[model samples]
Target: MKSTMLSMLVTLLLIYLSVCLVVFLLQRKLLYFPTPPLLHFSPPMEATKVSFENGGERLSGWVVNEGRAKALLYYGGNAENIEYNITFFKDNLPDYTIYLIAYRGYGDSTGEPTEAHLYSDALHIFDQVTAEHSQLSLLGRSLGSGVATYVATHREVDKLVLVTPFDSTANVARSVYWMFPVSLLITDKYESAKRAPNIVAKTTIIYAENDNVIPRESTERLIEAFSHRLENSILIRSADHNDISEFPEYAVRLKRALN
Candidate 1:
């Protein structure tokens, strides 16, 4: 009877360890759902294709209203098709040029996505394009919020908007994978809270009331990190993480912030 009990304990231990190993190895895979570019996704608007070399690889995206005096650089969600916003910006935001691009391994960009790579590429692209526009605003949604926060901290951003933002990827992962040691296992710990205090840009944050993907607590934590009062912190009623932007109030608030 003693031997059987010991054997059962050993088996359970091994199984738990095996599960942990799987979670560690596949963390990024579960986090990033990169959507491939559509070849025939030509919207009925005029947009200039922008391509540049970063670390010997080509990075590409679309620029609408290219010669405008101001620019808004948009960073989208994990599984977002950025081209979907082309017509909206072309019509609604005539005051500023819009820059929408995919991260590496997403859309038509080359290479793979990583926290380090995304941060590096965002800053590089911002520097390259800043010369063309007098002022630059940044808007990041979901996972892209981390990338946007990183840029705002490092660069001189005129305005910063974080939609469905989180305090840190580690904390968010811990909330989801509470059974495992997610903090130690997570590689891309986009620690926006740590960088928030450093950003002096006029900041606006909008979050969904029913964001199951990123808990309400996470967005609240991010809001707390900011030193000053946020220009606007509107909560979209009845909106979820994926569908927040679809709501009329979401666009209305965004237009007000940028304008």
Candidate 2:
């Protein structure tokens, strides 16, 4: 009986270690989806194709309502194409120019996506956009929230919006893989929660009532981390993480936040 118990314990330990190794090796693949532009996609008439060079790689995207005094830069989810938002932004926020810059390895942007590269590229994109528009605001959703927080902490931002955001990628990973040591295994720790206190820009947080992708606990933690009171905290009722944007309140809340 003693021998059997010891053997079972040893087998479980090996299995746990094997799974940990696999997760460590394939973590990047799991985090970044690198979605290409959708087929039959049409660029909004007001959108002009623009590109910026960062870390020796050229990243391309669209700039709408160029020369406007107010500008908004949007950073999307890990697997998002970002083009899907061009028309919506063009229609909603006429007062400000819209920037739909793609992450490296996403859309027409070159190179692969990593936390370090994305953060650096975000700053580069911000500097490029600053040349034309002085009043700049940032909008980030899901994984991009991490990038936005990093930029907001390091740069000067007038306004900020986070949609379905998380406290950090490490926490989210731990929530999913409770059996594993996700904090140690996570390669890209987008610790937005850690940097929230330093961000002083007028901020708004839009989260789904039922966000399965990012637990409410994670989102709430980020909200509580902010140093200043949020301008708005709108919740879309009966919304999931993926379909939250589809809810009618999504665009309405976003428009209010950006404006």
Q: Please give each candidate's TM-score.
A: 0.96, 0.95
Estimate the TM-score for candidate 2: 0.95
Q: lDDT per residue, candidate 1, 122-222, as tens digits?
A: 98899999999899999999999999999998999999999999999999989878998888789999999899888888999999999989988889989
For candidate 1, the lDDT comes to 0.90
lDDT of 2 by residue, 1-259 (tens): 9999999999999999999999999999988999886667778689898999988998988888777899998999878888888888878888899889899999898999999999999998899779787789999999988999999999899999999999999999988888899988999999999998888888999999988899999999998888456777778999988888888888888887776
CA lDDT of each prediction against the hidden true structure:
0.90, 0.89
Q: How far off is residue 79 in model 1, in Å?
A: 0.7
The collision pairs in model 1 are none
Question: Residue pairs in steric clash, candidate 2?
Answer: none
Assess candidate 2 and give its lDDT: 0.89
Cα RMSD to native, each candidate?
1.3, 1.5
Q: How many residue pairs clash in each candidate?
A: 0, 0
> Which stretches in model 1 have alpha-carbon errors above 4 Å?
227-229
